[model samples]
Target: MEDSPRSQELLSLEAIYPDAELDITSYSGTITISIHSADPVGISFAAVPNTQPLYDSINYLPPLKFFFQLPETYPDTPPTVALLSLWLPEATLTALHASLLLIWDDFRDMVVFLMVDHLQEQAFVLFGLDPPIALTEVQFEFFVSYNREQLQEEFDTQSFTCEICQQYKKGKSCLRIELCRHIFCKACLLEYFSTCITAGDIEKVHCPDYECTKRVAEERKRMADPKTFITSGTSTRDMILRVVFTPPLSLDFLSFLPPEIVTRFQTLFTRDQYEFFKSNFPNRAVNCPVEACGHGIIRDDVNDDLVVCPKCRYAFCIHCTNSWHGKSMCRLAVRLDIPEDVLEQYLSYPELSKDRRDLEDYYGKFKLRRAADAWHMDVLFKEMMANELMTACPSCGVVSAKMDGCNKMTCHLCKTPFCYLCGEFLDRARPYDHFNDPVSECYRRLFEGMLGTEEELMRPIAPGFAL
Candidate 1:
């Protein structure tokens, strides 16, 4: 089968951003692409849209980088479009990944287009212009035409205005209120709902005008459920694909295609990834560490740290992706050896870093440090690694016991001793004086300072007394 005309145009874009160099991976029989760059990340579609002439469809300028991954076989299968670096929230991203399972036979171009159209409408409202007449991606100049003026006049006369505030408007940043044959600002509706009104409290947001209540309620119900935007057989997928895929195309409507296209296409690229652990160490039951947890994580669940063991209080480490060690009674020293390396390696993998970081930020409260032994070891390590003692003079390095005792001492090196107390190099003429020498005023001061005065030092203190 020949490449779709739309596919050709997108292929040209992919030619610039190929698969090999971009850290693309194929795991569990599905292609996965990583988007780590600070710039707009990208995904390539294997087959480009093949409908209209490439030149004619060249007008849309998408901010995200787009790409296609074409399998060797054509038309018999649909290509996957990878959306790069788009600012989607984690929950939304998880939803999108799950939604990909229902594509069946058509490319989701329509759904993408609808979302983009909605976003563009939002942008227009934000820019202080008269609302665009249609929810489509038309050039900015198109909104400047005579129809805009007519739409503006018609909209101004409509009952879309908030009745309480008497402000004529369609929608605001936070609210979207609609009345009979018109939409009101969401901000106004919310304000009216929470505050006192002449007609009792607005239990649910209602059009200030009583005539629009039924229509507004119906629309509000649909908006409350996010699932309405994308579902198994709905046009939501079609609309979403249009925004994510440039020049949307319906593969099911193609003139030629395979008989089992839907089944085969659905299975080839999954939006979901089921997880199970494989053991690297001997006899270890390589499963999710959550106690009594036989159930594994679905791709969507991987986004959160609350991986509860279906049967118990066992929660796996979302960071190290290990069993929960925080709840155990082992001392810190004992638990410190809990092969954190595997978790480190898994996290260091390029694809998992961003995801790991996000999970870290979300579950920041759960870092476990329960082991007392581990705490002791940590203190010892820190003391040994203190900055001041990390290095020493070559001559006195091994001989001097400055690490544990008073600094005043002589180095055995070269028989040319130095005052460890004063840190002064000395010769036989001014040979170091021991405690017995009357001229050893420095030694007397040092001993007095460390051991206290003879009278006070002679007195014993309590066993637990601290210096």
Candidate 2:
């Protein structure tokens, strides 16, 4: 027995689209045709009226489904076709339906294949709409998500060679880095990144492919500015900026790693970024004074000592590291009044030693610990101020800090010239001669302790100063 024309058409479609659902007996089925373009197509979405549209580029769109029932008359009578899509407008669907009917009317033969071919080729330019198909916010979101899902699905069904292991693997067993689109087996990525995170090598957490890493590094170097340089010293501000700016790896690939490893990666990456920001912008960056909230705060006004921590909203004076004292002299000279000798002796003993215990008992543990904490904080405050903030004038012994400029400094009180780096008195007639002299340690090091220089600031910070 020979098959009917309708059955033959259905069989041919079934062969072409193996995944399509078809009923040979009923001569009815649904088939999906994916839209593809040689170049990426632009899509724009207007979230609200009178606003510019958000734009994105993609190479794929959601598949268009064709539902058909072959009539007994078949090619002579054309199959009934209905077009359906998640993202296409109703009017576009109606137009597509009319186009399919025209194709059948002109061909008067098996036109399903022709319709599918026309859709595949013309989808991007359908209705003569130019690039950047305009869509509503909801439709845009739906199309993007659907497109991504389709791409992922397609990837998962294929096989690739992982560069890391040099082994062929199914896409489901591999992980793709979103930034570089490099693929590696999940097991290899897990082991390699986990080791890096555990060893505190946050920089190695990026794509392991040599060419990819080199390209990324070159790009980063090209984008490098003074702000990207990190110093050796670590601080609370450094950590905060790191956490905010430099994530360890893309979150998509991080899922392949253990939770602990992911956490470690984040910690190390943040710490690294924090160190860089702290090193490059010492004067502009200060740690929040709150004991429990030491977030980094970068200042906009160099003269204003007032700082408000973004993390804790604790407003404080940068110089005093105390609660904000608006328009008033910093009261940093105030101390906890613990006897120096007692505080020294208490600190010399090991924390758990009997000597420390005996001192704790004699001074009363709570009182002694409180005094010790205050003393330690004062010492830290002094160190930070000296190392990063202020320098004492060599002639009058007046303490001051330069917001920015060359190494040559002048005493505001005595009007004596000096070198800010070594605090040595400069020749009155030739103050810069000190730095220009090759024999002088400060020679050619005027910018030392600034963003790019390797040398630390050399200003002498007095042990005691009145504010």
Instruction: Give the alpha carbon lDDT tens digit for every residue of 1-467 in model 1.
Output: 23553455334433543442321231001122321222221122212354332111111222323233434333344445443423333454444334442342455332322222333343333312221212222332332333334334545555455556657664322222211333445555444533422233322323456656565456435433323333335443243333222111123321122434323322321211111111111111124554455543321222233455545556665445465566443232233223344335334556546544442322221231222234545555456435222223345553343433343455556554555544455455655455435776455533432345564477564232355
Off by over 4 Å in 2: 124-127, 215-224, 227-244, 298-304, 327-467
Quote the lDDT for 10 in model 1: 39
TM-score of each: 0.20, 0.63
Residue 124's C-alpha lDDT in candidate 2?
54
Q: Hey, what RMSD does candidate 1 come out at?
A: 28.6
RMSD of 2: 19.0
Give the per-residue lDDT of model 2 (tens digit) for 426-446.
Answer: 899888888789999988867
RMSD of each: 28.6, 19.0
lDDT of each: 0.36, 0.73
